[model samples]
Target chain A: MAKREYSYYPGCSSQKGASSSNMMKSVATMCEELDVQLNEIPDWNCCSASIGYGSGGELPRLVMSARNIALSEEHNPDQDIVATCAACWLSTREAAERFEDDENMFKEANEALAEAGMKLTNKTPIRHMAEVLIEDIGYEEIGKGVKKPLEGVKIAGYVGCQTNRPFGIDGESYENPMYLDGLVDALGGDSIPTYEKKVQCCGGALAFSEPEKSQEMIKGIIEAAYDNDADMIATPCPLCQANVEIYQDQINAKYGTKFDMPVVYYSQLISVAYGRNANDAALNGQIIKARKLEEIAAK
Target chain B: MSTNTAMVEKYRNNFLKEVEANVEEGEWVKMCMQCGVCAGSCPLGNAWEHPPQEIFMMIRAGKREDVLTSDSMWMCTSCYNCIVRCPRELPITHIMHGLAHYAKRLGIQPKGNPTQWFSEVFWNNMMKKGRVNELKLGLSMYFKDGFVSGIKESLKNAKLGMNMQKTKRMAPMEFFGGHGVKNPGDLQKIIKKAQELEAARIEEHGK
Candidate 1:
């Protein structure tokens, strides 16, 4: 059988956010072991997520995402474009869907791509790395590679709004999705049960548009995790990581509550549990400021 | 001769009207039943003068100014508790957000709150770089917000953050790369959309 590979688009968040980049690095290592190749698409641009749409309408946003997709198409025919950023996944997935669904819109988008020396044919699927792992690779296979399991720790899995919302998967309601929880459970960690806010927006760019309000949203998530008695929170989106991590301290200060739990990328947790070095797994910059995991791993 | 309309129905405009023209999910607003479930589940409802349920009532009563000017808007955490628990699924959170934006535009600042420092620093960072630089942004927020006392405490743990940044344990700042819409035209294109939305909102409210 030919070696399986997918073109990876790191998107803005992964490129800029250290935690997100580390998660991608760990994911790349795991992918290597799993016989999966991640080809980084060159010259890819922004996904223009909620911020873009809120600021620039759908067409400009679609054109921006389509340009990135076009770059992926030039490199690979009929291969899915895997993304690590939730905003990228949402934007690219929406753009790909729109390009395929609307002929006129597709022509306009392709025309814009031509300016960037690219073209979109709707030939590839835009996928979140989490989707590729959970849906394509399967948790059982991932579990098989685990040299160290994350035992005795309670984890609150935050999927964020983009991954599960706008009704992406067929027959799966975004609100009550269990894909991340399944992966966490497969890794032998306790996936704490959570309700509605688990999938709410982490106030991504709203950190710019409305900072205090955004912090409030972050505080709410932290509070929920605390209420659930979770030791940490895990997520797949870089924006969510950045927002939740940055606001956690503020949240703690605002309410005079001690929420010193770590917020990590799901892949980082997996990489750590697989006996990877804490440095290798990028556990150092976690927002919640907990050293328990590192202490345990050191032992 | 008691005519039947819920208190929420009578006071609906308290919150709803403030959001009447601005809500992205307007369908949710009409479905609110004033069940108080939203306020009841709200984590910070105790801090608000008008909890989520009352805010919604105020909105529905066309009492837009009260909701917009009230400190209650700032107290909302945007946690979506009201949105989730409301049988009506009224976009309570959305309304609150819209009101906040509106209030900001009108210069209705929150009093004696450290959270305001976050807003100032965040926008200043974004306005300059067109994207957030976490390390600088965080420090700016802390310093500007008068959290200088917390700075030394936070710095004690700075080694971890610095190490992560150095060893690539965390995402690097260069990835965002100031690639924001730099061209004047592109920036305008982005700004115009927001302007249109704001204009439409104001027109709807007869402002």
Candidate 2:
């Protein structure tokens, strides 16, 4: 089979030693196994995130992403750009949308890009990894790759904000997306039927700025999963994983709540289920160790 | 634009008017109709000093001092929950960030908006390197206020940091050998050009 090639924009979060570096490795391995080729955008910069727009106006933020888009076109022409980071996905897609909606903005952004000796026609379709799995690679194919089906593990699919809203899966409900749940089911895990926190926000970058307030939000997301008897929490965004997983102990201490929730990425679960080792899934960063995932992988 | 002071202030509301005039995305706040979907859907709605709806009302009421000084402006996580749920399709997330930016520009940021401080540190790091080195960024954000506070905060997160290191999650070497892109000069040029263009655009409005 000729590998389906895509221009991959592994956001800053995937850099070495960053929180989701392991997720990057896992995505690479899973892609190889699934026969989907990821040609990374050469020397990609930060997406300027939501904060980018907040600090600078629409134009600078637009240029930041537009520069990347222009580079992707220059290097990987005709190939769709795929972002692994949720913030990267949102910012890039948001830029694309703005360019498409307004002709003046598109022309102005291009003029700004000309200063950098680049041009972007905004033709490339920016897609998240979750969307690729659902559309490009079918669930049945993913299920067949599962050497270790997560038979007994019950997962709460925490879609979070970035991946779910503004540009979520085409057919999925923004209020209550089920793509994660569907992926869980494909991996042979039981997904919680009414995970109320599935759509809840995990305070993303706020985990740093306002820890107390942000942890309260993280607490609700994890607690809801535990309350529903979920063994692990699966998410798409790196910030969501960092906020929800990294702060469990701190949150417990702060709020006097008994909680130990393991947060894993959707790709991590897929990587392990596809017969790759736990390390490939970057399972070590999981503060609340996923014993269930380990046991299944060991089998 | 009318130079009538009180009439313009009372009729248009200073806060909302400033937001509309200054913030590009903040123009959509006029679409908000006191509907509470943005507030109701937010995970930290109750925690906010002024939830989404109340913030809208406060702007319309011309509570400039209150709006800029409130913790509510700094508390938004940029989750887009409010944006996705707002029936009026008001871009609440952008407006919230815009308010924070406006407050920062006016030097009226509230006392303890650590997130706002964190965001500053993060943006500076990104601008310089075209990438974020977590370890360096973390230290700068926590310690940006002062070394004493940095030590206190680092001690608090020492265990988490240690565990992250052991797990190979935190990139330690990045602090010493930054992971900026190969062509840092090119990235810096792009950043500078964008910044210059943005400054020019703002000048067009500020005048």
Q: Highest DockQ among the candidates is held by which one?
A: 2
Q: Model 1, DockQ value?
A: 0.10
Q: What is the lDDT of every predicted structure here? A: 0.62, 0.80
Query: Model 1, stretches more than 4 Å misplaced?
Result: A1-3, A16-19, A168-172, A194-197, A289-292, B1-207
| Alpha-carbon runs more than 4 Å astray in model 2 | B1-18
Q: Output the lDDT of residue B198, model 2.
A: 56
lDDT of 2 at B171: 68
CA RMSD for every model? Answer: 8.1, 3.0
Residue B196, model 1: lDDT of 49
Candidate 2 achieves a global lDDT of: 0.80
Give me the overall lDDT of model 1.
Answer: 0.62
lDDT tens digits, residues A221-271, model 2?
A: 888897899999988888888888888779878989988888888888888
Worst 10 residues of 1 chain A by lDDT: A49-58
